[model samples]
Target: MIKGTVKIDAKICKGCELCIISCPQDGLGLAAQFNDKGYRYVELIEDNCTGCVNCALVCPEAAITVFRQPKPAKKSVEKK
Candidate 1:
């Protein structure tokens, strides 16, 4: 379960919504404010991202970049 974040170039984004749809964790959404091009860009809406890069692969404009970090390992408990 590698967690990650997405960086989107709002100015370069064409508001195609492909990245938003491709995200598996539903981590992305349209921004509330418009970009320099007067188009609402995609943004990260949640922290449960898995760094799958699905959004980046589907993006036609190549406006999205993903950064991933390894998820912390869970502690194991011993039975008494």
Candidate 2:
């Protein structure tokens, strides 16, 4: 059950790394690159996210958001 989840507002983000440390599950990280404002952005790693939304709550910039992945659709079988 692997998925990508992390919503960030680049314009509002100041790259403080507060979200990085706040994550109890270690989901958030500082990306290798910077945004248009030259601020290092945050990203989510699959093995890391527990969807606690700790990062979202601690973010002073209101830049981070977490979402749960949608469940897979079930298949229908035909009967004779």
lDDT of 2 by residue, 21-65 (tens): 887777667778888888887776536575667788989988877
Question: What residue pairs clash in candidate 1, if any at all?
Answer: none
Query: What TM-scores do the predictions have?
Result: 0.81, 0.68
Q: What is the C-alpha lDDT of each candidate?
A: 0.83, 0.72
Where is model 2 poorest over a 10-residue stretch in terms of lDDT?
71-80
- Please provide, for model 1 over 1-80, each residue's C-alpha lDDT reduced to its tens digit, 9 standing for 90 to 100: 66788888888987888887878788898889998888888888898888899999999988888888744443222222
Of the candidates shown, which would achieve the greatest lDDT relative to the real structure?
1
Candidate 1, residue 9: how far the Cα is off, in Å: 0.8
For residue 64, what is the lDDT in candidate 2? Answer: 76
**What is the Cα-based TM-score of model 1?**
0.81
lDDT of 2 at 39: 84
Model 2 quality (TM-score): 0.68
